[model samples]
Target: MTPKLVAGIEPPYYTAVFTSIRPDAPEGYAETASRMRRSVEEIPGYLGHESARTPGGIGITVAYFRDLESLDAWRLHTAHQEAKAYGREHWYDSYSVHIGRVERSYGHERA
Candidate 1:
């Protein structure tokens, strides 16, 4: 599916990602991205997410969900948190997170 980012007037959600993985990681980058992508698909509120590797750093992603409750549930999930910890301790040199809500959204997909 080709997902497009539509304009939104909503509260707006914010996500901050910072990372510095060792050179060896770029070699296994596809595997790591696949793992993270699968993990996201398992979460309840999980709308979508992505990850990318670059010469300088890694790109992380997150997506919009139904509500804060769904978001919170994903947040508290044990495996999710474990993956986060793994990122902090081994995968990433540093990172950050900023959570919020969207105030509005406008767009539609035609099938």
Candidate 2:
């Protein structure tokens, strides 16, 4: 299946698109990931997010924040930092993070 392009916030917002390849059923990963997601939502300036993963364990998660500073805050969060370390040591085989500022946004929806 194809990955979906996340619908982002209004222009001038920031997004962090994280893509990762993981081992099959990595232990403790699901719990840690769920905790991290919930934790991020409570942070100031968090807008929203979209995430999906393939059957092959390739996944993409796009997290939106009000600005670069908010995004940086998440990146530096202690729990988040620990999760990143765990990903490097045990969960992910490879990963990539792309950050961008949305200049414009338009979409169509059927009623």
Candidate 3:
């Protein structure tokens, strides 16, 4: 799949970097992930996100927000909280989350 890069965002935003290694039997993971993605879009101060996964079951999703408050809102979201619990119990073998402030960002695209 082609990655959907979040464009037009300036510096000083925040990012929640979620990296996970899924188990072989990841039942219900795809549907729940899709639901979470759609739910996040409706949140206030949500900038955008980029995500990808490897055939080896290593996945990464980086979600951007306008500030710490917005990121906190996502963390406190009921659906998100539920998803996290489910992921811990069923889907993932291991996972890590890192929150960071983006001081600067640059990239290149070819036409």
Using TM-score as the measure, the top candidate is: 3
lDDT (0 to 1) per candidate:
0.58, 0.89, 0.90
- Candidate 2 segments exceeding 4 Å error: 1-8
Model 1 gets an lDDT of 0.58
Error of 1 at 99 (Å): 0.6
**True-vs-predicted CA distance for residue 41, candidate 3, Å:** 0.4
Worst 10 residues of 2 by lDDT: 1-10
Q: Cα RMSD to native, each candidate?
A: 4.6, 3.1, 1.4
Candidate 3 on 1-111: residue-level lDDT in tens? 576578778989999999999965478877998999899998899999988789898989999999999999999999999999988988888999999999998887778
What is candidate 1's lDDT per residue for 23-93, written digit by digit as tens? 44544446765776687568665565434556766554545555676677767877667777766666666
Displacement of residue 16 (Cα, Å) in model 3 is: 0.4
User: Alpha carbon lDDT of residue 86, candidate 3?
Assistant: 87
Clashing pairs in 2: none
- lDDT, residue 108, model 1: 68
